[model samples]
Target: MITFWMQMRRTIRLLWSLFKDAETRGIAGVTTVLLLSGTLFYAHVEHFTYLDALYFSFTTLTTIGYGDIYPVTAVGKIFTMAYSVIGLGVMGSFLAVVVKKISQFDRRR
Candidate 1:
């Protein structure tokens, strides 16, 4: 539990820093939309709880894929496959911005 909060705090700080750039902010917005769409899709199609749907969406998009939750329905599986493909690109774009930020910060020191 403490680790989770610490991680969240780290994430918040990273995002706050990332949003200082317009291009990165745009990438973040698009990534957020993709994740939200996936979350809602799972909640509607698989009837998962909101938090579970959100968790599944995050892990799936990030490709961390814990395998703790999965879709059993054929349609749900198909959608997940499609979502993952698009999400990879979306997440890739966002991560690129983060990497760029890290590089810029490193160069300053």
Candidate 2:
């Protein structure tokens, strides 16, 4: 098992690489914006707590619908559908970039 400091150092360097790559077109930034947007919308419209809303947003974007929590209202469902559609592409791209960076980091070791 990797120790905490090792993980932290790898995380820092990977994030720096991502930050530099983000200069041209920030898919990561767009993903973050969408996540926050969905979280805020769910929190307000569905009466979810801040943590639940953020959890829902993350699960929805990653297409990992656990079904433990979800939208109840009609407006919430419609908004969720739209949000999912847009978020999927952005999240997928973000994951791809992250995986690429991790591979590069591994190669350096």
Candidate 3:
């Protein structure tokens, strides 16, 4: 089992590595912040549970409107539009990172 000190050291090391990978880190950080804010807004405005809010946020961000939940308020709609525009770039960057990483792995094989 990892001790608390070990975990802290490990976390720090991983964070440092992520910081070194500036493009990946920036994309991930922006995505996380946007998703968190969107989830919080949805939960507060639409009275959704945290899990539901997160799910809805991911679904919407990925452009997979399952029609399970939707925005009724004007603010929510506006936020949705904003999220779509900004989140798509973050998502695209993440996808680029994933593809690049995969290609690197493939080259090693």
Candidate 4:
């Protein structure tokens, strides 16, 4: 338990340092906007609760596609297709930035 907490603390510190970088902040901002837009769209269009919408958005963006919940309407389906493509790209970029930053941080340490 102590080891787990120490690892969590280290991860949080690393994330904070990563967010301080300009490139990471830019990608994070874009990713945040994408996630929020998807969450809001699903909530309004699918009549989902905010929590459900956010879950769907995160799962969709991460390409998890649990299929437990999905878009019912035609517009919702179309939006989801486009959203998946764009969100996946944004997520990929965000991950790449984080990985690069972590590697640099490790090297410095």
Per-model clash counts, in order, read 0, 0, 0, 0
Cα lDDT tens digits for candidate 3, 1-109: 5698887876676555555777877788888998999899999998889998999899988989798988889988998889888888889888888567556544755
The candidate that wins on TM-score is 4
In candidate 2, what are the lDDT values of residues 1-109, reduced to their tens digit?
5798898988898778777875314886787789899989999999999999999999999889999999999999999999989987787777787788779778998
Cα lDDT computed for each candidate against the true fold = 0.89, 0.86, 0.82, 0.94
Per-candidate alpha-carbon RMSD to the true structure: 5.1, 3.1, 6.3, 1.9
After aligning candidate 4 to the native by TM-score, how far in Å is the CA of 31 from where it should be?
1.2
Query: Using lDDT as the measure, which candidate wins?
Result: 4
Tens-place lDDT per residue, model 4, 7-79, is 8998998989997899999998998899899999999999989999999999999999999999999999999
Ordered from best to worst TM-score, the candidate numbers read 4, 1, 2, 3
lDDT of 4 at 79: 96
Residue 11 of model 3, lDDT score: 62
The runs of at least 3 residues in candidate 4 whose Cα sits more than 4 Å from the true structure, single-residue gaps closed, are 1-9
Off by over 4 Å in 3: 1-22
Error of 1 at 65 (Å): 1.2
